[model samples]
Target: MASGVDLVIFGATGDLSRRKILPSLGALVARERTKLRVIGAGRSHDTTDQFRELVKEASGNPALAATAEWVTLDYADPASFAPINALITGTAVVIFYLATPPETFSPILVAIANSAMVTKGDPSRRVVLEKPLGYDRKSAKELNAQLATAFDESQVYRIDHYLAKDTVQNVLAFRFSNSLFEPVWNRNLVETIQITVAEEEGIRQRAGYYDQTGAVRDIFQNHVLQLLALVTMEPPTTFDPDYVRRAKRAALRAMSPLDVTSAVRGQYEGYLDEPGVSLESRRETYAAARVSIENWRWDGVPIFVRTGKALRRRATEVVIKLRDAPLDR
Candidate 1:
């Protein structure tokens, strides 16, 4: 709450809005509610007052609820952008959020960029893109180029919510802060690395998106890859954000051109029966791969990455299997 700003969420009526994003914001600005002007915009017909009430119920706290104000937006109407446009003018830091589907992303950004009264170079404006930015590698690049037209590199924040978990944070603290791990962190002592992210629930309400994305795009593209980078990345020169990101990028880059010989893709039983799924669906609900890093420190060792929905156990962690000690029997 250091500065007063507009906090706009585009998909305000979506399930993510009620379940996590809105409530997290409430918790964030509970002490300094006045610093943040929470604005929720969506296609629904709810007024600012009615949407305010929805925020209250979803937030489960009166103070958090009072922070949110809503604006009705229709994708087809030019006039619907008026309220948000008015709010974005002369902004300090407009933390614009696109909490909607990937398909709506490009159009919304275009609308925002086109409708804003101020210049696109406004230093205060930033857009936070949710996970699964595109369907695949090609589309991802196009989406990146499109987003760049509106916001500079520094002004864009692509979020991987799993990175915010306490368990994940703890790993960084242990790895960097402790000097002992580096001595035995490479292929010399580590036989193989295993990273797993599992889910117990099936494709409940997200079949339309899930059937298209499956575990590969839904999990591996962002979550699993990020986890792999974090666990195996070379130690940075320093723990600063840029340096840390560099190490992670290098780690991921080393594993390029994934070998399909060690990869597996599977569809969970009864996935076709899920609502919005096709009977002839060839998509995979489960994906596992053996990632081989072609670097000096990890040349021979393989990192096994796996993620799936409707799994028996739900867990997420990085496991470094060490080489057994040689002994005279």
Candidate 2:
């Protein structure tokens, strides 16, 4: 509707955009923090009118539905990226939200770079990406390179929504704010640290996708590892971005690959017996492993992480099993 304030979505009609993104953006608009002009780009066959209606239904939020714009795009098509660039010509801010999958990331970046719509050296032009950053370290680096070719690392905001949660922030408060934790957190005072995330659910519908990427790539690589990093990272002299990231990367690097014997990777059978999936594929439905950080601070501490689909209840928690005090008192 307006010239300048645009919050564009690369995949507007998808599950991520409709279910979470639109509602969150609507909340921002409701609070009057942003004057939003949502531009939805995807390769849908439907017209703008049909797409808008779809968004209205998908969003289910009355506030966001009132302010929605739909534009069709194909990342595979070279012509699609220019118009988006033209829309960003004025002083309007641009926020590219990539709701697409990990595989589509490279081509999308290439298109954005080749397109006429992208603006370099603009602070307001930000791109938000969700994790699992990559299937592994190599893929993550590859992804970083592709984007770095066109945009600076500072321009990329790698969003881990878990960091936004109150529980996660509380970990920092418990560790740094209290004398109890910061002092006795070393190997001398502490024993093994077990961080477990176990689910009882089976792969009811996501069998196809889940089969391809098991617990390691899906959960441990991002959420569990990130949580462990936050919990175990040394207190920074000053809490700055560079220092915090450095600490995390160091913790991650310190962790070695898990031994399959100590780790349990299980998959529930009879899923394909219900409907779509075939019998031959043996993708894991459940996995649990103990990750040890080989450092002076946490030399023998073991961090256990477990996750699965179609469980009885859905729970995500980190338990710090501290070592017991001596029986002298």
Candidate 3:
């Protein structure tokens, strides 16, 4: 860390880095951003020049890659984090992005905790965990407990890129900023909130990961539920981080209990034939659930969240249906 913060992306050789993170960083560097330093870490033994070349090849921008430094180490060996530790210089903030999978998260966190990167309640250090936090409540809690050993809640950022979409990010502004909507944003006027995240591409090269994760663990647990929360959350006391986060937590707490009868899971027609997929796999490429928020404002409204892969549309959208007027009939 220096005057600005250091952003270290673990699993730099993975698909996430090549596809999203690196490209986004390239774009950011092309714009107005200077002091921030970025370091890419992974198991790649490629030299600094080679790794920079890889970044350039993936991002199609030489300047951004030119600004980055690479650290290579075998993920299985916790002792190998020494190189990364050596790079954590100065007193500026150090932000670690766990760009790897959920399985690798714990080991990486433990390794980080063992290192000097994360000390007792160090606000200068932060960790960002990507989507698919955990499969269920129990596992989610387990992961959270593990994460707590390293950093406080404020220092951990559970990120869902979908929530950052322009349309999705404007949810709070669209609701509270408008005086007319909040008054009528209740079950009396709204019928249903349907959130659909559909992906047209089949499991191309992620069969091993997808088979275990499926739509429920993959999308519903993070993105779909987050969409539901945004739609269901109460107007916060103020538009600050603390207030908004508490409001969301309260709203999510009021969410209805899951009913097996109201849930559906399905696999695409050709999913069994995907490479690395076992024929006996009952993995679901699609999942839909009907949830009810048992709160003062959303007592009877049903929030329907659904997500699927290799489906009709490649889109993420939230639709709110209004109740018809009594005189409609």
Candidate 4:
């Protein structure tokens, strides 16, 4: 195995980094025994030692801290990326993980393109981006076009980490491997499918990003839609990633556009009081929609998806209701 790999995280000081990324890295290092050189990049003035301390606290791994480094990166200034370029060697396998908001994606991509960190079509270099990729369809396409300018499609990974959940992955195996479920997985025997992702935690430090993104763009657009696709998509020809992606895309294409009448949006009671949130903000903390797929397997079946924050309890669940058994006269 390669001795080590370089991982540069853009929003290293953010909540996502502290709560999710760093902790995961600790586990990764412990389990896989992979040598990772973690370079935490942000606009913060944290020194290398201070950043390492933060890494140790977040990841609960001293070894990760021992090899950690920090660099100052300002999305507005392309020149700020030089330190990052200097840290990485020419032949090193570098993974640039953009943990910042979607709005900053463009400027950062431009900076990365101008830097020596990425070489087009080089498999050794990769970029991992979090969603929502854009505000809407047109912007998503534009962002994708910009990415193509800097890196090959194969080298760019637009990821939704929710898909990595064991239950989510099991959705595929449970449906395909089980003879009992596969036969009745269609519209004939299924009544409705409900996918709910609820959280008790408020926006907290994510007020700026969450306010602009709202519930739809934050959760519904990528995560909820992905779950729906996995549940409704046809069996792929093979377990290959491309084949699975094609099947998922086909499932999404078959979904009817969400009707305004079938959707509901609301803001939590104390959401306005959150810091950094606009006093006049009307963004929804909760969103629900009734969706349908026109494909033969799913026609006439209602698929309801709802996600919210500061709710009664925290849960992520998918409920598949089955139709009543036939009566014998």
Measured by lDDT, the strongest candidate is: 4
- For candidate 1, write residues 260-313 as lDDT tens digits: 888999999999898899999999999999888999889999789999999998
Per-residue error (Å), model 3, residue 184: 2.2
Tens-digit lDDT track for model 2 on 111-141? 8877745556667787888776777779999
Q: In candidate 2, residue 279 scores what lDDT?
A: 79
Name the candidate that leads on TM-score: 4
Tens-place lDDT per residue, model 4, 183-263, is 999999999999999999999989979999999999998899999999999999998999999999999999999999999
The TM-score values for the models, in the order shown, are 0.90, 0.87, 0.90, 0.96
Q: How big is the positional error of residue 274 in model 2, measured in Å on the Cα after superposition?
A: 7.9
Question: What TM-score, to 2 decimals, does candidate 1 have?
Answer: 0.90
Q: Which stretches of candidate 4 lie above 4 Å from their native place? A: 1-3, 326-329
* Model 4, TM vs. native: 0.96
Q: What is the C-alpha lDDT of each candidate?
A: 0.83, 0.73, 0.84, 0.92
- Could you tell which candidate, 1 or 4, scores higher by lDDT? 4
Clashing pairs in 3: 1-89
lDDT of 3 by residue, 1-329 (tens): 45676788998877788888888877776686645566888876868787788789887678767767788876778898988888877848888998987878878888888877787578889999998887777888999999988788889898888876898889889898999888889988998989999999998878757888888888887788778888889988998878988998999999878999999999999999999999999999999988889999999888888899999889888888888888984
**TM-score attained by model 3:** 0.90
Kindly give the stretch of ten consecutive residues in candidate 4 with the minimal lDDT sum. 1-10
